[model samples]
Target: MNPRALRAAGPAILIVAAALTTIAALAYGGAADPLATGDPGPFVRWGLPMAKLLVNVSAAVMAGSLVLALFALKAGDREFDGALDVSSIGAAVFTVASGAVGFLTFLDSFNPELSAGPEFGAQLGRFLTEVELGRTWLMTMIAAAVVTILTFAVRSWTATLLTAILALVSLIPMATQGHSGELASHDATVTALSLHVVGAAVWLGGLVLLVVLRPVLDARRVPDVLRRYSSIALVAFVVVALSGFARTLSAISAWEQLATPYGGILCLKVAALVLMGLLGAWYRRLLIGRIDSANAARAAKAGRAFWTLIAVELAFMGIASGAAAALARTPPPATETPYSSTPAEVLTDEPLPPELTFDRWFTTWDVDLLWAFVAAAGIVFYLAGVIRMRRRGDRWPVYRTVLWVLGMLTLFWVTSGPVNAYQDYLFSLHMLGHMLLTMGIPLLLVPGAPITLALRAIEKRDDGTRGGREWIMWAVHSPFARVVTHPLVAAGIFVGSLWVFYFTDLFRWSLYDHLGHVWMVTHFLISGFLFVMSLTGIDPLPYRMPYPGRLVTLIAVMAMHAFFGVAMMMQSGLMVAEWFGAMGRTWGPTPMEDQYIGGGVAWSIGEIPTLITAIVVAVQWSRSDERQQRRSDRHADRTDDAELEAYNARLARIAERDEAADKAAR
Candidate 1:
C-alpha cells in the first residue's frame, strides 16, 4: 500500500478490524447472546460492547495524542494543534460512548422497560444515582465531557499536560467498575486492569497520533518525532505486557482454562500484542534511523516502510482492543467462590487469611501489584539514571545508589509483604506499615537525592516540547511544590496526617477502596519525603530550615507523634469500629489489645526512625560546624590573620581613646 494512502486510511483500518473482531469474539464467547431470563434483547446486548469499543478507542486517542503532543511536538505548531484537535474529537466520542454505555448498562443490568412513563424515568434516575456500576459510568461520562472541553481549549504546555492527566483519570472509573472488581483478588485485578488500559491507550493512541502527523511532518523531522514516540511506546509496551500478564493470572487459574472460550480470546489478544511488540522492535532498530537518511530517495523509502508497518501495527492494536472488550463481557474460567457472611469477607471481598504467626510474618505475602510495579520502576529508573551519569563521565555517588535501592526494596516490602497481607486483619501490622512508609523509607530515600541525580543525568532538551527532564524541573519549581516542600509545612503535614487519617473516615475509606488505599500510601510517602528533605536531603530545596530550627521542628513533631500514639492507646472505643474492630480476627490479640499494640508500634517502633533522623541531623550539624571552621582557617591562612589583626587593632584604638578621655578629665 502507498504510504500516504495507508497513513490516511490507518484509523479506518483499525476501526474496521476492531469491529469485525468484536463481532466474531462475541459470537464465539456468547457474550452478547440472549440471557436465559432477563434478556435486554439483542440490540442492547450487541450495542453495549460496540459502544464500549468506541469508548476504549476514543479514550486511547485522547490520552495518547496529548501525551505525544507534550513529548514529541512543539507547542504552537500545526502538528501540536492537530494533535489536540484529534484528542478533542476523540474525547467528544468518548463522552457520547460513555453515556451510551451507561444507558446500555442500566438496560442490561436492570432490564427496565423502555418507555416515556414517569416510572421508567424514575427507575433510570435511581439507577444512575444509587447503583455503583451506574455511578461509575456516569462519572466516566462527566469526566469525558470535561476532557472534551479541556482538550479543545488548552493550547499551552501546562494546560495540555493537565488535560492529559484528566483524560487518564477518566479511565479510572471504568477500570474500577469492570469484571476485575468482581474477582477474588479485587485490588490486584483493579490495579492491573487500570495499568493495562492506560498503557495500551498510550501505545495505540501514540501510533494514531504519529499516523495523523505523518502527512504534515517534513522528512528531517520524521525520524526525531518517531524516535521520541518509539521511546514512549517502548515504555508503554512494558507496562501493557506486565499488566496484561497480571490480568491473565487473575482471570485464568489453570493452564487447561486456556482452552476455554474466554482464554482462547485472551490468547488472540496476546498474540496481537506480541506481534506489535516485534514490529515495534523492528522499526525502532532499523527503519526509524533510516527515515532520516540524507539521501532523499532513501529517506522516502524508509518512510514508506515505516508507515506501512505502522498501519499493520494499528490493525493488530485493533484486534487486541476488540478482544479486550469481548473479554470484559465474557466470564472468566475461574469460578468465583461465593462470599460467606464472614465479616472479613464481607468487608475485604476475599476470605480471611490464615492466622498470624511469627513465621507467617516473614512468609506471608499478599503482593500489592500497584506498589510492586512502582518499586520496580523506581529502582529501574534510578539505576538507569546512575548508568547514564557514569557513561558521561559524571561521578554519581555509589552510596546514594545503594540507599535508593534499599529504600525502594523497603517500600516494596512495606507495601507488598507481611504488613500488607495482615494489615486488613491486624491493626498493629497496619500501623507498622504506616510508620515505615512515612518515616523509615523517606529517611533512606532523602539521602539518595534522586531529584539531584535526575537533574544531572537527564540531558536537557532544547526543543519546545517538554520531556521527562523538563517536566521534572517544572514540577520542582512550581508554586505548589514550593509551598508543600516548605520546612514548616512539610513538618506540619507529616505530624498532622497521623491524627487526621486515624481519627477520621479516611482510614475507613482506605480499608474499603483500593483508590483510597493508594491515595493514603502516596500521601504518607510524599509528606514523609518532604519532611526528610527539609532535614537532611542532599537535593536542592527552595528553603531549608537552619539546623537548630530543624531540630526544634523534629522535637515538636516527635512530641505530637508520641501523643497521637498515646491517644490511640487510650481509646476506649475502637477507631472505625465497623472496619478494624469488626474484622472477625481470631488468631491475633483481641481488637482492643491489637489496637493498643498498634499504638505501641507507633510510639516505639515509629520513633526509632525519628531518633535516627535526629542523630543524622546532629551529626550533620557537627560536620557543618567543622566545615565552617576549616573555611575560617583557610581564609586566615590566605590573609595572614588579617581579620584577627583588625580585631586587635580596633580594641587597642578603643582603649587608647578611653585612656585619653580619662586623663583629660583628671
Candidate 2:
C-alpha cells in the first residue's frame, strides 16, 4: 500500500474501533432508562440493545474492510492485494451474519414471555427457524466467495457468473420486501430489515470491490468501471432512501410528529445525508481532478480527503441505523388516538362528501392549454435554432439559447397549474401527476443538455478573455458531477423519499388535511423528478450503466411497483378518505379492490414508458457501438495501406540512387 494511504488508514481504523467500543458498551449495559420506567418491554430489555450492538459493530467492520480494500486496490503488491479482497468478502459476511442474528434475537426477545396464543407462538417459532432460509445474504456470501476463488484461479467466467448471481439475489428483497403495506404493519419488520441490510451490502460491498481493483485497472478502463459502479450505486441509493422513508412515514402519524423525538431523529438523519452529499461533491470536484491529472501528490491528497468524507458519512449512517432501530420498536401514529376521534365520527361529521364535485373540464383546461402552447413554442424555437446552426455550421450560441429556454419552460409548465393540481388529488390523479413530473419531465428536460449547451454558448461569445464563464464551465465539467450523479447515491434519495411519506400515518393524514396535502404534493414532485433523472440517460451523468444492466434495473423497478400495488390491495380497511378514492368517485367494491386496481395501474402502466425507454436506449447504444467499430476498422485499414505503399516507394528511390552512383563510378 502507498505510505500515504497507510497513514490515512490509521484515523479511519481508530474511528471504527471507537464506534464499536461505544456500541458494545451500550448494548451490554441495557436500553437507555427513562425516569418513569426502568424497563419498557421484553424487546427493549434484550432485542434493541443486541440489534444496536450488532449493527454498530458490523458497520464498523465494514468500514475498516472498505478502507483496506481501497488501499489494496489503489496501491500495494500484486500478491498482497488478495488479502484485501479476502478482507472485503469477510467484511460482507460478518456484516450480513451479524445483522440477521441481531434481528432474530430481537424477535426472540420480543416473545420471551411467550404470552401470546399457541398459534402466535408457533408462527414466531416458524419465522425464527426460517431466518437463514431463502435469505439473500446466504446467496451473496456464496457468490462473493466464488468470485474470490475465480480471481485467484484466473477464471473470468466464474467470476462474472458469481457477480451476476449476486446481483440477482440483491434484487430479490426489492421484490419480496419493502412493500408499503407490509411496512405499515409490524409483521414484515424482518423482511424490511433484510431488504435494507442487503441493500447496504450491495452499496458498501461494491465500493470495497472498486477500491481494491482500482490500482490494477488500466487508466482508460477506470472511468468505465467507475461509471458502471455509479449506476449500480444510484439504484441502490434510491432503494435505501425510498424504503427507509416509507418505514419512517408509516410510523409517524402527522406533521406534528415532526416536532417530537422521532421526527427530530428523522430530521437529523436527513441533515446527515445532506452533509454527506456535500462532502461527496467536494471529493468529486476537487480530488477527482488531481487523480485524473496523474499528479501523485495531489491524488494522494484527494484520496485522503475522499476517505475522510466517506468515514464521516458512515458514522452518520450508523446514527441513522440506530434511529431506525428505535423507530421500528415505537408504536405507529395511526395506532395511537391523537385526539380520541373515532372512525365513524370522522366519516360522518365532515361537511362535504369528500368527493370531487368540481367541473373536470374547467379544472384541467387552463393548465392543458398552457402546456400545449409551451410545447409548440419549444418545438418551433428548437427547430429554428437547429436550422440556423446548420446554415452557420457549428455556431453554437443559437442552439444553446434554444436548449436553455426549452429546459426552463418545461420546468415551469410542469411545476404549475394542472400538473400541480393532479399532484394534490387522492389517488389516481396524484399518481398521474407523479408520472408526468418524474417520467415526462425528465424525458423532455434531460435531453435539452442544459449545462453543455450553456457552456458552448458562453464560449462562442468569448469577447476578449475567459473569466466567469470559464470557471463555470470548469466547475460543471469537474469531478463534482460524479458525486451528484453517483448511481447508488441518487437512487437512495429517490427510493427513500417514496418509502418515508407513505408508510407513516402521513399517507392518510396527508390526504385528509390541507397542509399535509401541500406537503405531499411538494415531496411527490421533487422526489419524482429525482427518481427519473437518476435512472434515465437524458442528462450527462458521471456514471452510467450498461444497456443490459439498466434494462434489468427497469424491470426490477416495475416489479417493486407491482408488488406495492398487490400489498395495498390486500389491506383490510380504507387507507385514504372515501371522497379521495379512485377517480374521486367511490364504487361498490371494497377499499381493498380500489387499492388493488391502484396498484395494478401503477404497476402495469408504469412499465409501458419504462420499457419503451429501455428499448430506445438499447437501440441507441448498439448503433453507437457499431458506428465506432466501423470507423476504427476503416482507419486501421487505411493506415496499413499507407505504410506498405511508403515502404515500396522508399525501396525504388534507393535503387534509382544506387544505379546513378554506379554509372558515375564507371
- Per-residue lDDT of candidate 2, residues 269-337 (tens digit): 556545645654565556555655567777667655655555565565555445444443333334523
Which digits, one per residue and each the tens of the lDDT, describe model 1 over residues 1-666? 565687679999999999999999999998988889999999998998899899999999999999999998999999999999999999999999999988998898889889999999899889888988888888999999999999888899889989999999899888874542232338987898899889988988999988887878765677889999999999999999998998788779999999999999999999999999999999999998887788889877887888889889989999999998888788888866665678888888778899877898789788888899889999999999999988888898899999999999999999998899888888998999999999999998999999998888887888677778888989988888889988899999999899889888899899889999999999999999999998999787777788999899889988999998888899899877888778777776998899999999999999999999999999999999999999999999999999999999999999999999999999
RMSD each, Å: 1.7, 16.6
TM-scores, all candidates, are: 0.97, 0.42
Q: How many steric clashes between backbone atoms does each model show?
A: 0, 27
| Regions of model 2 farther than 4 Å from truth | 1-125, 128-182, 185-203, 210-259, 294-296, 304-311, 330-353, 357-666
lDDT minimum window of 10 residues, candidate 1: 176-185
How does model 2 score by TM-score? 0.42
lDDT of 1: 0.89
